[model samples]
Target: MNQPARVLRMSYLVASLAGVGFFVLSVAWLGVWPARRLAEDAKRTGPGHVVALTPSEARGRVIYAREGCAYCHTQQVRFTQADIARFGAPTLAWETRADTPHMMGTRRIGPDLARAGGTRSEDWHLTHLYAPRSVVPASVMPPYRHLFAGGSDAPRQEARDLVAYLETLGRARELAGDEGEARAATVSHTHMEGLTPSPVLNPHPARPRRTGEVPALPANGDRARGEWLYARNCAACHGSTLEGNGPGAGGLTPRPTNLAEHTYTDGRLAQALWNGVSGTAMPAWRDLPLADLGALVEYVRDPRITSQLRHDRTRPAQGELAFGQRVYEANCAQCHGAQGAGDGWAARALAVAPTNFRVQRLWGTAAMRILQTGIEGTMMASWRSRLSGEEMQAVAEYIVQLYRDEQDLRAREGRR
Candidate 1:
């Protein structure tokens, strides 16, 4: 039997009220709740205080967005093994709270930059910005010529502002230091609850260089292979002919080292290649094969090829060695070690290990220059204000004499 159907319908006022309630619930669930969660997370894990961007940094960020820098580079480090291996820990919920729209892009045409701060010096960033291909031969990024006054050396204000902003990327997290890192690690996730940072404990490899000794370099590397590698990797800042007068040298004060002017020990080359020269534009090349590094050592140490960046190799008198030792003990020993072994009391505290003079020797002219100007990035400061030029020469000579094998070094230098 077909019963008479009756339609049950709410009155207009009741229907309107129910629909409005549902809409409100949806908004609270989808929008307001997540925002509140993020705010609380920010308070917990963020660097103890909020830092507003400076005017320059703000402007740079605008430019960064306008230029679509975010399109290729991602700011977020996800909680995946590969991401952590390449880009440090996963980006915390609090890290980007200050970001207006967020620069966390999805694509990875370039490496993540959430922690790019202090990893590279300003010069490297500027050089990379002005002409990507100049420093990195395989870069696909287009040149930002408009940001420069002319060449890379002549960066406009906009360029500087952009770099300034980049420098602030991970500053807060790093400054929060160990306390903040601990806070971030406590974040509970389905996959990462109470676990450690990554599959490997190594830091990001885009690198300011690892401090301490480099591993043993390969012996008898092919010089031809090294020369080819140098042409590609080293010839830009260091001239094609090794003259230290590459087109980019105009921008760097204290300038790219004239590798050809001075002789280097095998150990010295190993340190420079492995750890990079501290406080200078020289960066680590540990990414290269050990064989490649050894080959480079061969070409660089070859006397015939050196002297392209000729400075007077005239050395101080042998009599200065005793005086030099005195100066070194009195003033240089605390950091360079009493015997120039780079194991001084303060050496471990420094970001870059002091040069191991036990194995590496700086020649006369080069040593004199390093004394007057100082190595900008390392603990080595210019002694010009404290020591007389003669005293500096004495100390420099003392360090040179500390070379592990004096006869081998003399033979390499072609001295009797």
Candidate 2:
């Protein structure tokens, strides 16, 4: 019995020692070793060097954490098929090497922020931060209005800093180019080694890729349904009146098309809705049913059917027209084309093509506004400094007359 008691005591001691040894091993293997490896890897991997956050970016990161932006937005792109399909290649471990706490958020209440940089213009961000609904009528994300001093047009220093920080989010990865991506693929867990990665990962991956072919429209469309759809989707950017003066229009570069004045072929509408306009903030609505898209097109083609409208009914006074004609010849003809066809000598060089005034009927007041403020995101510059109010009004009136002349000429030719 005493010998048995001695054996039991010895076994108890051995067990305690074994437990202690296991704890030490776990700490070294699971904690210390991994941390050291990560540190070393940070020094070597990613664009071949560590990407230290700039002072402004660091401050912005602090703000991002404090604001709980991570609660809604995720920074990590997982290895799952869905994530890879949507966010481009799987995120490498070394990609977050410079991140101190890391912004790999737990949930995705909003879109991923991993590839947000350079996807949108600065103005779009400013307006969005000020009032999400202003630009995206259906956005569930809350606005960061406090970031602005007054209007979206006038952002405070903090706002600028925040945007600057935002602009840096996916910049390094994009700047990494193909070589950096290839280097990362070799060491990353996802085994994306050797294959060339897409140069620019899409920020809004929910949108369909451009297929170059317009989706087919339904055989027949309901104008009423199209009206409702237009109000829901197009009105925020294109304006409720189709005048291109929506609350969000002011912020967009290449301001939203004045749909009422601009005539588009059915094919152009289909293509724009299906693939979105490149180099613009317009998003593809491929998720919508074909019938809905057809209706949207129908409604956009003739918005006047659903609602009563008001326009300047009075024709341009002859003196006003004569003065406008003189102004058009001297100043506007070079860019607007002699016949207002948007085929001016300089039109070829412009990124966003000039407006063809002959095809569409512009609101006189809207034309004056364009002259005063200039269309943002295009070659058009504000004439506020160059022309007097009377001259601006005269030129705007002349532009309206161009459409009238074209319509009258077409009517006469048809009769003949």
Candidate 3:
């Protein structure tokens, strides 16, 4: 209001304007100006790989923005134990350095979407997006069916573009540099521990003589025997049709493999059935009687009614459910959970979570194998010496029953 006060106010306003203008100029210099200069430089530099954006990809980017996917799924991954433990590794600055208005999302309502490309086949992505409950029953994320035409056309051109964009999120150049060295070191460490090295181990040791030796097939090879064995032993996880959609499939990570798509020779199938696939959840069936093992193998190899022959359907006489319950409560409940959801008290501390008994596909193939070898690089210790073979067998049978009960409950709930 006064002359001196007005003069001071005018001076402050000028100074504030100058500061704001300088800040804007600094940002332009560091960000927009350099990026434009770099583009011009790259053009003159010649012959650099330039990714041409497809029409669908451009549209998908628009869709991503419109849907506010950035609100839930962060593109950036921080370098931390929790991040690396859940996801694979930390993000590199150069990976997103090329991005204009970079899609480094801030919120993390879902897992980071970086490196989502090729994580699973297209079919899995389609099924997952259509109904998250169908794949991961526990996922709280909402379905995105409206994105497709009438909620159909999953695996559409747009889906492919989205997947491609996700695949391009990681620092591919940096990963290629050190992946081999890291893998080699891991293999060396595993071998040093006297455990079977992973399948990726190169220049693998010579196959021992016992590797090729398979026991003889069962006499009077009954298809009925195989069916009964499967129902009692294998049906919990592999599903009744061996499609790998057993009632328990929903809870496991890395999910169950659909056996129908798998290609293996009769011998290889037999080997998998008998010895199990190393470095995975599959377990070796070394303890099953030689004839019973052969019968089960034949049944799985040729799962047709014509393969059926009569065999005993009798349950093991010594396996009382009451006794098995006692054993589970005493020894298994701490890690597998009281309800067998695989989230025991100790599960949170583990890098790879414990197995959910509700999913049979995880425990399919050889229950005995899991009891024999346990999981590798984790605390799932072998229980062969801790429990008697009969007790182990009883526990396996109980697990199968538990899977069936869960399936029945789910079906009943669905009807409601």
Pick the lDDT winner. Answer: 1
Please provide TM-scores, in order, for all candidate models, with all chains considered together.
Answer: 0.77, 0.72, 0.39
Q: Per-residue lDDT of 1-416 in model 3, one digit per residue for the tens?
A: 88999988799889999999999999999988978765654343322343544676666666667667788898765555455444544444444556666677998877787655434434345555656655444677877776455432335566566645554544342344455335334323422353332222111111112234566555334667777876666554466777667654443333454553232334444565664433333435654566666677657656653222323234544537667777787888888888776678977776445656664332343566677877544577899889998777777656555543343466799999
**Candidate 1 per-residue C-alpha lDDT over 250-319 given as tens digits, one digit per residue, 9 for 90 to 100:** 6664467777755667877877888776555677786788899999887777646655445544565767
Candidate achieving higher TM-score, 2 or 3: 2
As for lDDT, the candidate ahead, 2 or 3, is 2
lDDT of 2 by residue, 159-257 (tens): 777877788877777777778766655566435444445334553532433345676898458888988888888888888888778988776777677
Cα-lDDT of candidate 2: 0.74
Error of 2 at 230 (Å): 2.2
**lDDT ranking, best first:** 1, 2, 3
Residue runs of model 1 more than 4 Å from their true location after superposition: 1-4, 7-37, 193-196, 199-202, 289-291, 298-304, 307-320, 323-338, 341-356, 363-365, 368-399, 405-416
